[model samples]
Target: MIRGPVIETPRLILRPPLAEDLDGFCELMADEDAAKFIGGLQPRAAVWRTLCMMSGAWSIRGFSMFSVIEKSTGNWIGRLGPWQPEGWPGTEVGWGLLTLAQGRGYAAEGASAAMDYAVDSLGFTEIIHCIDPKNAPSIKLAERLGSRKLGEAVAPAPIPHTVWDVYGQTADTWRARRLE
Candidate 1:
């Protein structure tokens, strides 16, 4: 498996997924509101597969979402990071946090680090976020990250019925914004 880098932010830790994250994954997926935009609610068994998928992505693809851990509590709050599964529109940095974890700016903090990792380490030239149109909070976060709505794209199978608005910024734009 890919021994991915562990990133420490002031309030969070971004690290690779492991078997131990199953319970946290299930908790996140079980909450309706938290799971709504993220492929709807999933059962525990399916969540196990999700955890396995993220862990295996590290093994097979060399990158995937990192488990977002709250530094103070040392709890797994969510997963957010670089992802570009088969047939994805582009290299992307995505975020998903549990209900309790929302509104704390964790996604933004962790995602910014993930974006840096994607560009600096993963060699991504551009980054995109496939967001549902109705997800106002996510749209705001993407905009906060200096991304604009570039257009729309349908996600890969298991979730092709819905079209997602793609928001993005190039590496140059990201770097320039960071300097400002």
Candidate 2:
């Protein structure tokens, strides 16, 4: 039997989301600051849907968003991993941190680990980061992942719908010459 991949960083651990994480997941995604780029705080049902979707991704795609826990405190700070949204081309690398977790560089660190796992361990060819144009921090994070702008597209959003696309990159190219 295959066990889930566990990605470790200097201060974080990215592992599969567990049932115990539902409440923490809701709180993180519901935070105003953390949810800004994601449209906004969603209803509890919406949070449940997200959890189910991530779990489904693991079973269907062999990879999914992971619960990001602070190694030192073991607190659930956020999530980061690969997901394929409807109409999207490839697996997208996404991160959502609790409001308190912002500005700590944890998102970037966790996402970098996920990207490496997607490319090196899972052999994925492409990764995308779709971010609202106004979300400058997310845009910078995408660039740090070696992704390039890919224009925008509208889709059903958590709140008022919007279109956003910050970057896309192929694993082979990024692994060879990653952006600075």
Candidate 3:
């Protein structure tokens, strides 16, 4: 089994999903607004499957999104990190935070840490964030992270999403951004 690493940020802890995180994960996945960009509201059963898929990824792929926990409240606030499944467009570091966790810069903080791990530890040469064009907030965050719109691509089927805006930067650029 893959031993997921614990990544600590200034105000968040990025770790593998635990069984206790089911409630928080389900709650976020159930929120229409919060789940809109990622995927529309999912049933509890679907969320359970997703949780299982995420945890399974660590064992099967040796990497997956890290569960974001608020350091102060010890809450599972979101999930963000390295993600690249079969048929995926490219290597990506993604993020999704609950509505309650919005506007706090946690997505940025957690995503930054994830990217660092991806490029430095995992030796990823490039990273991307697949975002819906209508997702202005995510677009802004991607830009803030120094990723520009590279192009558009169709997402996997059954999701009803089309022409995702792909924002990305190379590892060299990521390193330069860190030094700035």
Candidate 4:
């Protein structure tokens, strides 16, 4: 098993995906609205594949989305962090959370820490978030993270028909922003 880093913020714990996280991950992806931007509603079997994919990525590439846990409740809330799947647009620090976890500023808090890890530890000089064009909430969050709209790009094979508005910042820019 991949022993990934355990990152703690004020209210959340970010760690690698585990077998036990399946239930919460399924719950999050089953909700229409919550899963809409991340991906359409996924069935249990598909969610299982996704969970395995994340785990496999950790084993194969040494990094993948972290299974997010709410510190106070210790509940598996969602997953978010470094992600660079095959045919990806760029090195990314993406996020997806359970519905109840939204509107809580948790994405920003968690994403900041993930971005730090990707840059400082993983040597990623640039980080991007590939967001759907209509995902205003995500667009807002990306902006909040100091990522500016870079341009649009067609999504990879599985979603090639979909075009995304890419937003990002270089490590130098990210570091400069952090000092402010």
Candidate 5:
């Protein structure tokens, strides 16, 4: 079994999704607000498929989305980690917070922590956050995390939409963040 990386923030724990996380994951994806940029509410089967995909990431690429949990409440909040959509520029750092978890900086915290792990520990030199143009909050989060706008590109067919690439910590940028 391929075990994924675990990251801890001051208020959360990021780990691989367990079988028990399936239901909560479904609920999160079913939320309209959380689903804004993520197409729409997914069927239960789709959520299961996503969980399987996440598991496969560990097996195939040695990394995948980390299930976000509130440290205090110990509740599953959402997910954040490295993902590679075919035809993207590089490994894409992404995050999604449930409706109750929104506006609390959890998304940013999870995303930033994952970015650190990707570059510093995993030796990833290139990372990007692909955000839909209309998702202003996500776009702002990308910028706040020190990502430079890398222009736009049309994603694949099903998602035939243009998204802006938010560049994360490259080797040089990672080095710079360390100095500051």
Candidate 6:
């Protein structure tokens, strides 16, 4: 079985999803506003499936989003990390936090660690974030992470998303940005 690595940031612990996180994960995906840019709100059952999928991804792909735990409260705050399913647009490090967790810079902190792992550990040459055109917050976050809008592409259908704004930087660029 594949095991996820536990990654720690200044104020958060990035670890594999646990059964204890089900409620928070459900709440995040159930909120229309929270799920808007990522995907629309889903029923509890769907959310459970999603959680299982993320867990399964670790074993199947050896890499998946890390569950973000707030060090202060020990609560599950969100999930962010490397993700690349079959036929995915590209190697990616994505983020999605609870609505209450927005604007705290947790996404940036956790994602930075994930990106480092993607490059330095996984040996990925590039990383991308497939963002919806209308997601201003995510777009801003992508920019904050030194990723520029690379272009747009059609996502696989039935996902209800239109042309996606792909933002990314090469490994060299990522390293250079981190140094600055």
Instruction: Spell out the clash pairs found in candidate 1.
Output: none
Question: CA RMSD for every model?
Answer: 1.1, 2.5, 1.4, 1.0, 2.0, 1.5
Error of 3 at 99 (Å): 0.3
Q: What's each prediction's clash count?
A: 0, 0, 0, 0, 0, 0
Error of 3 at 86 (Å): 0.9
Regions more than 4 Å wrong, model 3: 158-161
Per-residue CA lDDT of model 6 for 37-148, tens digit only, reads: 7777888898888888888899998888889999999999888999987778899999999998999999999999999999998898999999998999999999999999
lDDT of 2 by residue, 1-180 (tens): 223787789999898887778898889767888887764888888888888878777888788889999999999988888877566645788888887888989988888888888888888898888788888888888887778897776654433567777488889876875454
Model 6 regions more than 4 Å off: none
Alpha-carbon lDDT, every model = 0.93, 0.81, 0.92, 0.92, 0.81, 0.89
TM-score of each: 0.97, 0.88, 0.96, 0.97, 0.90, 0.95
- Give one digit per residue, the lDDT tens place, for model 4 in 53-90: 99899989999999999999999988999999989989
Candidate 2 off by > 4 Å: 1-3, 156-160, 178-180
Candidate that would win on lDDT: 1
Model 4 ranges with Cα > 4 A deviation = none
Weakest lDDT window of 10 consecutive positions for candidate 4: 153-162
- Per-residue error at 148 for model 1, in Å? 0.2
TM-score of 5: 0.90
- Runs in model 1 lying further than 4 Å from the true structure: none
